[model samples]
Structure formats: structure tokens, C-alpha cells
Target: MTADLDQGSRTPLVSVLIPAFNHEGFVERCLDSVLEDPYPAKEIVIIDDGSTDHTAERIAQWVAAHGSEIPVEFVRRENRGIAATLNELAARSHGEFLRIGASDDYLLPGGLQAQVGYLLSHRNKGAVIGDSIVIDGEGNRLHDSGMCDLHGADKRLYDSSDGIRRAVIGHWAIGGPVTLLRKSVLETVARWTEGLRIDDWDMFLRLAARDAIGFIDVTVCAYRLHGANFSKTRHTATRIVNLTESREVAMSRVCLFDEPYRTLLRAQAQFIAAKIAFLQRRHTRVALHLATYASLLLLSKLRLHRTAHVHAEGA
Candidate 1:
């Protein structure tokens, strides 16, 4: 669908997409956070993925209360997984930019302004990601996110063509909720990869492969950590396995220029596999994966050191 921008207006429209699945307790706060934002041109789209809780009712109540203030659309569908819900939302969205909101996470004030401004200024960038604060289930701030703590006020524009590939190969560098993506860039990549537990991660990698991700140093959102979170659930082993496999599949799709980059990605995947095998108490598999992990790590280090030495000699 086309974005709803007035003929006379130059301000780009943004679509805030929320896929709700059973987050009854915190959904209102999440919705309120976005609604309270001062962005002049924006819309909220909520899709209730067969929530068994009162999430649907809460969303309905929210719409009734604030529907007139902002354009809001609500839909209820069977329990399609996260990837499918996101794809459907993308199809219905009418925004030049898209913010994927989590039902349990809250956007901080000025989040849209910060991200949208960056994207507008850097037309070549496909997405802009800000930092986030990690909060507890009760909405109490826990700490700065890993990205914030690691970067510590460095606001650098990354050419994801190489930077993002290296970052993801080493670790998960982008915060999902704090990102605002150009709709056209997402369309070029065809959106989220379906049926993977870490489809968001996959999407990030694919989009980065196309070389279009930016970073903003400001904290633009709060990511709530709760027991119900998929990463914290009792099925940790299964989730870990899915994560490893997803990384493997995603890495296979990208063609890295250097063999070392490919090896690092393979090592990271095996590291996750080793963790899962250890968790499941599969001794034989764990031993094999651990050996592979160590060897790969050594090789990666050696390669990096050699590259550095060559650069130093050139300097």
C-alpha cells in the first residue's frame, strides 16, 4: 500500500508496526509510548497474533481512547509466527519508513525523530539504529544495552557492506527494536526470512549485505527482559539450536570477500552449536563442536594478526 503523505507536505510518513502475541501486561505501555511521541506524520498498526490473553481487548480499548488522535489500525489473525506477522504488516504498511515495535518494549521519547532525521539526511542509508536501555519486567531500568556500553557515545555511520557483516559474524550488534528502516530497502531484500527463530537477525544480515545500515548513538528505546521472553524460556536448548542453524543458513547466503570472514562466521555458528550440545548433555557432539570451535578461533586470530602485520608494514 502507498504511504499516506499529503500532496503539500514534504514530511515523510512513518509506520509503527507492532505484532502483539500475548503481552497483555505490557502492551498498553508499549502502545502509549509510541502514541505519546510527537512525530507529526505517523500511523500505528497492530496485529494480534491469536493472543490468548486480554491483549486484543487492551488494544481495542487503546484504539477507542486514542483513535481520533492518530490513525490506528488493528487486526486479529490466527497464531502465525513472528516472521509471517511481520511480513503481513509490511504488506499493509503505508510508510516511507518502518519501525518494528515489540509489544513488550517501549520507545523512548524522540526515538522516531532521531532515527527518521538520520535516514532523511543520509539518503544512501537503508536503516538507522539507535541504542537502547535494558529494563526489567517491572519496567525498572537494569542497565545500558550491550551496544551502548560497548560504543559509549560513538555515533559512527557504518557501511554495512563490510562493517555489519563483520559485526554480525562476531556478535549481534544491532538492537532490533531501536531500528528504523527505509521501506524501499526492506522491499529490496523482500523482508523477513520466514520460519527461522531469529528471522530478525537474518533480515539484518541480508539488509547489511546490501550495504545500507547506520547507527545513532542516542538511546531511543527500552527493551524489557521478562520471563516470558523466548530467549529466557525453558526450551533454551531448542532455541539455541534454532539460533545456530539460522545463523548458518543466513551466513551461507552472503558472499564475503575474505575467507577469514567466512571462517569467523562458521566459528560463531559452531560456538552456538557447542553451547547447545553442552546444555543438552550430548557429550560426543559437544566434544566435536568444542574442538572445531577452538581450532577455528585460533585460525581466525592468526589470519587477523597476519593481516594487521601486512598493514603495519605498508604503513
Candidate 2:
């Protein structure tokens, strides 16, 4: 734990890493939310990922205006994707924990304090994620993400690999932007995969495999859903191909030690492929993928049944 000299208290430093890319309109508001936080021990690291707009300039102006009130570091670089930018930001961070901040999103009041306190007290947790409220481009509140509802009523701790796998595979209950992770976890896992579009999800799975994750039952941040959000491209052919390839890469790495997990991942991949093929109107390809999916599912169930029968006989 690092002590804050100004506050004369023991508080871990939380690094807010913002990867800005062409978000000229909302970047200032994002910075404002972080700077206004009551948490005394925090730093902001902003990396402008080759924004052609005035995003970098806006960041500079904000820093100039509030540099004395808060610690802010800004970096400008050529066009790299989110993964590369996140890697660079993580390397530059000096905090014990890292919070990823999208330029278009803003944290709710007391978010940092709540997350930091939870992580500091819970030594066994590798990361802490909270619920988020969805907002439109103009910052109008849409609705809660219902993450807390999905996770349960109270704060939950996921300690087992199976729990993590099921949480990720079954519903994807954790939100990346609303989560704060221990920096040591990243050190152990190396860093984000440089070129993968789903790098956040992949990293979360790896971290969960290594250590426990915590869920805080509160709305800690606001996620902006705008026209330019990356998820809007989900139905595109290029994005579908990328999603399939990325899932394969992630599953290959994590499923190496567990056959059941591998089988489940294979089934998921086939199901996704079937959906893509159906969208493309390839009837033959769709049928083949669906058949493969069903067969894999049945095989997985049989394996589970055999294991259960053996355990029952032993009992």
C-alpha cells in the first residue's frame, strides 16, 4: 500500500487509464468525472490513440486547467487499436490497481473510493467489477445494465475456476469498463493480446483462472452507447469473422488443461458459426455447423454423465 503524503494516510493509488480515440465531444466530461472524485490517491493516464479530431487538444486544455488539482499524464501516439493503447497505458501506470476508462464514458460519484476500498480490504480478489448505468450520446440516462441483478443481490466473490468460466461463458456478467484490476494480475498474465478485438474478455478469463474476482452490487459507472461504439459492427461480416477468430484464440489458451472446458468451447464455436452462416444465407454451411454443435453438446453431456456415475459408484 502506498501512502498519500497530502492526506497523510495509507491509501493505495488507483490509476485511471483513458484510451482516447476521436472522442472530442465527450473526453472533457470523462476527465471531469475522474478529477472531481473524492478519492485523494489517484492518477489519470491518458493516451490519445491518433485522434484526428480535437480530442488530444481537449485533453491538453483540461489538464492545463486542472493540473494543479489532480495528477494527469498525457501521451500522443500514432494510430493503434484499443489493445495496443491499453498495453502502453498499463506499462506507464504507477498505481497498484488499474481502472480502464473509455473517453466517452464517465464514472459515477464515489466509484473510485468504493472499488479501491473493496480491493484493498479483500486481499484474495484479483479484480472488482460493479454495475453500470447506460447513457446515450448526449449523456441522458437510459437504464441500468442489470448486472447486479444477474450477479445477485449482495456482493459476491468468485473463487473457483469453474465459477469464473461459467460466469464468463454463460452470461458475461462482468463489464470491462466498470472493473478495477490488480496490477500484479496483469504482470503475471503478461499483458493484453495486442491485436485481438476481444482482448478484454480474454484477459478477464485468464485473470479469473489465476485468482478470484469480486462483484460490488452498485452502479459505479455510466457506459455511453453512441453511434460510433465498436459493438455496432457486430452484424458485419468482418466483425463476425474477427469474433470467431478471437474466440478461438482465447479458448485455445485457456482450455489447454481441461477437456470439459475445451469441449464446451467447441460447442460454443460451432453454435456461433452456425449463426453466422445462417446470416449469410449459406444453408449447407449452417446445417453442417448445427449438426456439429449438437454432436459436441451430446458428447459433453455424456462425459459429464460418465464422471458422475463413477463418483456415485465410489460413494
Candidate 3:
């Protein structure tokens, strides 16, 4: 009967932020999923990141056709990185919680509703993330789910009975669709690190450190794994460079000085980095990872510095 819901309401104002690049072929599917969401969203903000294709024009046509029935706002900007586009959208957002959806990805029906319910139940939890179904370029199911096992010295888990302090670091098994972050938590962290090649992991770690994360334990969205995707196009070296830089930045912001517990976290971070390095064929990083684990196992004081030595020698 009214536009604004009552206070203490379980219903949340969800702002779906879809940052589109040159995803003209797949952007429509993404928007359709959001618009068809069982739970009504307050707004759907799609930012065009300077696509050299017809993505913006198509989005414009959709906006004109749909109008206010589904609040779709389109903004055009010069080609900037995904991080910058997200930061800009974050600044312009007006929702209780924000869910970022890539133009290539789509939200499953009732996905947003389920997550909103969970976030309401767990008010203290600033985020709720779930697993996703992996799909191919032709919209064919590739995997039942995109969940990771994350086995290694750095393996991280979403739900741990051992408590947050005991959980492995840098190992939150979450995709962008799985996570719906409170605007407050995001505001505290400020905008994402613009121009950075990879900011999701860094941002997630920062948020997890400040507040405990809630896992939905369900596949709520479809994650598209395609050749034209960012990860596919970007060179392996670019990924390594960005990940290394972002990890350092995130660690600097985290407080790990008071406890031996930090040792576990450091070890986990090293393992995760090692996996990325392994993927990129950076054998030297893999060695540094093992050395870091060794230093931690020996309870050495110069754990990270010694690992740095390993990196230097390996290089």
C-alpha cells in the first residue's frame, strides 16, 4: 500500500550493481534475471564502462521500454577498470545492501530474496554469500556449482565451528553473486581500490576481518565461465601483479601483531598466493609460499621477511 516499507521490516532495499563492459551479447540475460527477481529491488544500477560495442545502446533501449516498473539507471563513463566503475556506483548507491552482478552473470530466481532474508535474520553479519552454478558461454551448465575445495596450506572455509579466530585466512569461498554486503560495512571500507586489477579478494578480506561472514550454503546465482571474460583475457602476469599488490595493501590495513594466531593467517595467505602463482606458472612464488609455511611452522620471528628471502632467491 505504501512505497517505503516499515521500520524493523525484514524486506531489504537491494541495489543490484551491474557494471557492464563489452558484454552486449550477454548483458540482456543478466538484466532479465535481476528484473525477474522474486524479491523486488529498490533499484538496479547498470554502469557502462565504455564498451566499444552496442552494450550501452541496448541497455538504453531496455531502460526506455521498461521505464519505472523496474528502476534501471544507466550511466556511461569512459573505459575505466572494473574497480573504478564499482567505486563510482558505490558512491551513487542508495540501498541498505548492495549486490554486485557482472554483465556476464545472472541471478537465479529468489536468490536475492533468500539472501535478504538471511541478512535480516543475522543483523550483525555484514555480508551473506552463497555458492553459484557455473555456466558456459552458450548458457550451458558446465558444473553443478562453482564452490571450491580450497585444499592446501592456505585453504579457507566459509563456516567453521572452530570460531572466526581459528578459521583460515584469505580463504573465504564466495563468489560476487554469493555476497550481499551492508552499505554500512562498505561505507566504512570506503570505495574499492580503483584501477587495481583485482579488488574483490582484498575487499572481502578487509570485511571479514572487521565482521564475521555468513554463508548462505545454497547456489543462488549463475556464474558464467567464458573465454571473453576478464580473467580469460587478462594476461597471467597482470593477474599476478594485481594480486600481489592488493594482498600487500590488504595486509597493511589488517592488524596481525598481537597474536600467534596471525601466524596461521599469514600461512594461509601465502598458500593462496602460491596457488595463484601456480596457475600463472610463477614457480618462484610457489617456493616462497612453501618457505613461508616452513617459517611459520618453525615459529620464526622473521616469518614474512624470511619468506621474502625465499622469493628473492627463487627469483
What is the number of backbone collisions in each predicted candidate, taken in the order shown?
0, 0, 1
RMSD of 2: 4.5
Name the weakest run of 10 consecutive residues (lDDT summed) in model 1. 1-10
Better of 1 and 2 by TM-score: 2
Residue lDDT tens for model 3, 1-315: 002233556676888888999888888888888888778656888899999999998888888877668876789889988898988787777889988888888999877777777777777778777778888889998776676532121223455422333432434445546678788887666668776665776676566565546766667889887877636536776666766775575466447323344565666666657767887787998898888867774563465456658879999
Top-lDDT candidate index:
1
What TM-score do all the candidates reach, one by one? Answer: 0.84, 0.84, 0.80
Better TM-score candidate (1, 3) = 1
> CA shift at 313, candidate 1, in angstroms?
11
Candidate 1: residue 95 lDDT (0-100): 95
Off by over 4 Å in 2: 1-9, 146-161, 173-176, 254-259, 298-315
RMSD (Cα, Å) for all candidates, in order, is 5.0, 4.5, 8.1
Model 2: per-residue lDDT, tens digit, 1-315? Answer: 211123344678999999999999999999999987788789999999999999999999999999998888899989999999999998999999999899999988878877877777777878877788878899887766635543342223233445555465434556537888899888677788888887877777676555557766667788887888746665477767766775576456645425455576677678778877876889999999999989987887777677779879999
Candidate 2 collision pairs: none
- lDDT on C-alpha atoms for all candidate structures: 0.77, 0.77, 0.71
Give the TM-score comparing model 3 with the true structure, all chains together. 0.80
